[model samples]
Target: MQSVAEFDNVGLRYGTDAETLSDISFKLFPGSFYFLTGPSGAGKTSLLKLLYLAHRPSRGAIHMFGQDIVTMPRARLPGFRRRIGVVFQDFRLVPHLSAFDNIALPLRIAGIAERDLLGPVGEMLSWIGLTERADARPATLSGGEQQRVAIARAVIGRPELLVADEPTGNVDPDMAVRLLQLFAALNRLGTTVVVATHDIHLLQEIEGAQMVRLDKGRLSDPTGSLKYPPRPLVLRS
Candidate 1:
């Protein structure tokens, strides 16, 4: 299978002395659903930030959609990000915006037509059981409802890759199950989904999920390929 994203001996350092991620590497295949599991502050969120183009690797290389992310121009970043959908741990919705508008933000930014936007947004909202709350503001909605809105918004563009960070963390157990089902359905339709979470029970119940466990910035399974290998030099001095 073709790879959607790859990190080759990637390391992320926030400052001069601190290294949050050291020599991490993994390949996310197309149409695969992966759980990025790790304890708190294990660089799971940092890794997602790299995947979504929020941060560039301090060492090594990351390829997204066949382009080298470290060297990707700032002007081109938005276009690359458009190819991916990200659901943040915090539902980063605009408080003043209506639920419909929040879900429609991506399409609107992409300059989609009004008529074309309504159908999909409406359909997705209904799918997430948020149809009646379309006009409600984010501040008025419950946590689960906001989470569903975030999911709907992220998947609104039918992006090829979806990276969700702790998507089910705040939702009830039943709602979490429903959200997982929704993600699975999207995966069937060819979206490569990577969900980062600490909920082992929830992830275990799902069948055929490729689990990528991160420990202190290193991947556990498939140790040989992803055990924070040393960066490859194009040519030794």
Candidate 2:
């Protein structure tokens, strides 16, 4: 149970604004499932941003995939990012690409032959029950359908780490369950998963999952203490 990522006294803020996150710390274990839950403005999305390398922490140390990314060269960031898959809350699909092509984009970028991608992309569409919508653009699909396509695209490359932001927000309860199952299936194959959400009911859907709750830019374990860490060090914002 080696960790995929670790944070030590990590904090993030925008400009000189109030600290959005302070002294946050945690470990994301390999092949484990985690639910990052909190109220609005509790920094759930900010945490996801740090996990996926979208933003650097304003202070403290962070490591991912055994590399210290906070200090890693900018030129090498893309290589590290490719090992991780992110399912954004907005379902950031290419507006003009068909569902099949959107799912195929990762493989295409990885230099897989177009012919070699046909089987994998087709199988992903079928798994998401979107084979019929293979030719449909994101703008033409239902919310649930779009979510499925997004999830399909994220996991299609078989990444070692998967970070999803409120992934079930656009779908019904049944579809949420199905999507969670999809993640669970991927976890079985050794993908570490981190899902950020405000939905308490969704937390109950998965037994034995880890809970990392945030309160006003602070970290807490839902099963334990709620005390915010003291901000002893000087912060940027």
Error of 1 at 67 (Å): 0.9
> How much lDDT does each candidate structure score?
0.85, 0.86
Backbone clashes in model 1: 0
Worst 10 residues of 2 by lDDT: 228-237
- RMSD score of candidate 1 (Å): 7.5
**What's model 1's lDDT at 81?**
92
Q: TM-score of predicted model 1?
A: 0.92
lDDT of 1 by residue, 52-125 (tens): 99999999999998888798889999999998999999989988999999999999999999999999999988
lDDT of 2 by residue, 1-237 (tens): 456888999999899998899999877777777888889989988989999999999999999988899999999998888889999999999999999999999899989999999999999999889999899999999988999999999999999999999999998988888888888778768788889988888777776566789899999887542223211111111
Would you list the clashing residue pairs of candidate 1?
none
Best by lDDT: 2
Instruction: Evaluate model 1: give its lDDT.
Output: 0.85
